[model samples]
Target: MLRIIFWKLGFEWAMLLRIIRPCSDQRVYYFAFGANLSPDILRLRRIGVYETFDHVLEDTVLNFSQRGFYKNHGFASADASVGDCVYGKMYLIRQSDAKRMDYFEGVPFLKAHAKIVQQVQGKPFYFYRSQIPLNGLKPTQQYLNYLTHAYRNMDIVPSQYTEALLATKVLKTLEPQDQTGVFVRHLSRWPKILHPSLKHYEKHCHQLVEALWNRSLVGWMIRV
Candidate 1:
């Protein structure tokens, strides 16, 4: 009964709201995409994490989400139809919590680096992104590898502010190819990669997979 109730509450309502450290972590910041606009999400975030402003990067985008850039890569010219924006979430978690988020994102696919961007409230904050842009991610080879790893490791019940951002419709609608579809395709094809603990998220995982395959799923689309 408790498990069912907990699932109903969702991660933002559960861990994020209840898990935040007291006195505010100061290092943490909130980045909302869409669903996060719900008062419940914000209230929960306030409870689970610290809020902060002041950072190195200025927010160039006016909308809710921020971009995680890879410095060395030229703009992706091959896919013109591809959406101009790539979507991601960012938060200034302590190095300790950062490690856990990293595992969920698969640091191997997403290389963390220091970056600054504006939050929903127009405040500057720090975060990271995938290194492949600078390192040259082979879409053909790396895509499969990344998708595989992400499926196995990605935490559907996201704990970070960015996770909420990625799932938002804003990013999904703008993607050139179906972003979520591509994401789930890789995960479904690969099994035995998921950790044992994620058994709890299995239903959510199947839902994502089905959503991706059906092409009927709904979410945000980025504009650029």
Candidate 2:
């Protein structure tokens, strides 16, 4: 319940910032990799996003093969040497909504960093890209530990409210294990390959990480 409250508050607070414009163009473009992929999730959240640019995370593959909502759908792996570019669907969101997306993704939750992109129409704009980081995996480790114990005795699916509670439990459980440095160091060994397709793998990786993190935690905390 606390997590849900936090998410609601977070969205409300972020929506307040939407009044301020990041670009004069009003509409902002973003690359969504997670719940945005699931129409059901969007309907649940009441977030209105429509496809604008059809994209794919060209070089990357699914990082977590299980426990995520979307993994059952067949997808390719992101290369260690060259990350895979998985297919992604793009949306033109209101600048206000775009800011909310950033707020939800940054820090405590998933981090979606902005990248400069040139659209098919030759318009230069910013889009959010997600990845493990140039230094290496992040939030993933903290996320992993939290998930390990949080879901140890729970059902695979639970009520939405219970799922939210699990999110909090996972975060609290992992706070003591903040090993950011180690994860970043590990990245040095990961393949730093790029894909040729217009798609960017980092964005997809971010979405995948976020979805898996939330769902896995939720699945582990609830009673079937």
Candidate 3:
């Protein structure tokens, strides 16, 4: 019951903010990888894209090292490596949208903002990196489907890279240790109640992290 109430409150609060939030004219370049590479996902997330270009990050490799919302799989993160490259779309988006993205990415917590300056243009473009990197992880097949869909639908990324991603191993089933996965799996028992409960729990976690970063002295120091 409390979860449902919190979920309702959070949903209402988000809607209110969207109604009153001022749009910023300032724009910045953002590098998209993993699930973010999908235009459909971007649209669903309500991230506006002014323009997009196929860009490559030199000396960086894509890896599934970031623990995902579900314990059974991991999410993509860019890791620095010699003689490696990560190819993806660079989007020009409003600065306001970028801040909104910070919440979704769990910035200053699960992930952190990172940038690379282009040698040719001398402009910095931003990307997200995992705060903690773990090895020997695989992404879920459903997550990989988003990347493959983007690769096929966008026709921007190289074919070889797409094939490489397709060849990557995926987790076939959720591990018993995956708490969120287990919660979701049992949703069929009471979807109307459990679904909102899960959503509220996620919203509360995000709020807690955001509040800690905004109010703590350590967070201030880190921001500085």
List the candidate numbers ranked by TM-score, top first.
3, 2, 1
lDDT of 2: 0.39
- Residue-wise C-alpha lDDT for candidate 3, range 1-224, written one tens digit per residue: 34333433443343345435635467778888888887677765567788888777778888988765444467888888899887778888776666656655655224333434353256667887766666877898888888777776656567888898999999887643323321233555655756766755654553444343223211212110
**CA lDDT, every prediction?**
0.30, 0.39, 0.63
Query: After superposition, which runs of candidate 1 have C-alpha atoms over 4 Å from their true positions?
Result: 1-26, 44-124, 127-224
- In terms of lDDT, model 1 sits at 0.30
Model 2 worst lDDT window (10 residues): 68-77
Tens-place lDDT digits, model 2, residues 1-224: 23334544565555544443334356766654433545454444334554465554444442322122121221112223355443345677666556555544542333223343545456444444433333222233343333333333334323452354344322122222222221133433555552211123333443445543323211222111
* Cα RMSD for candidates in order: 15.8, 15.5, 10.7
Candidate 2 residue runs with Cα over 4 Å from true position:
1-12, 18-25, 50-53, 59-83, 107-118, 124-127, 130-224
lDDT tens per residue, model 1, 1-224: 23323333332222232234322344455332222223343342232333332222233221311122111111111111223332223344443333333222223222222233345446454334323222222223222232233333434323453343334332212222212221233444556566332433543443443333212111111010
Q: Considering only N, C-alpha and C atoms within 3 Å, which residue pairs clash in candidate 3?
A: none
Compare candidates 2 and 3 on lDDT and give the better one: 3
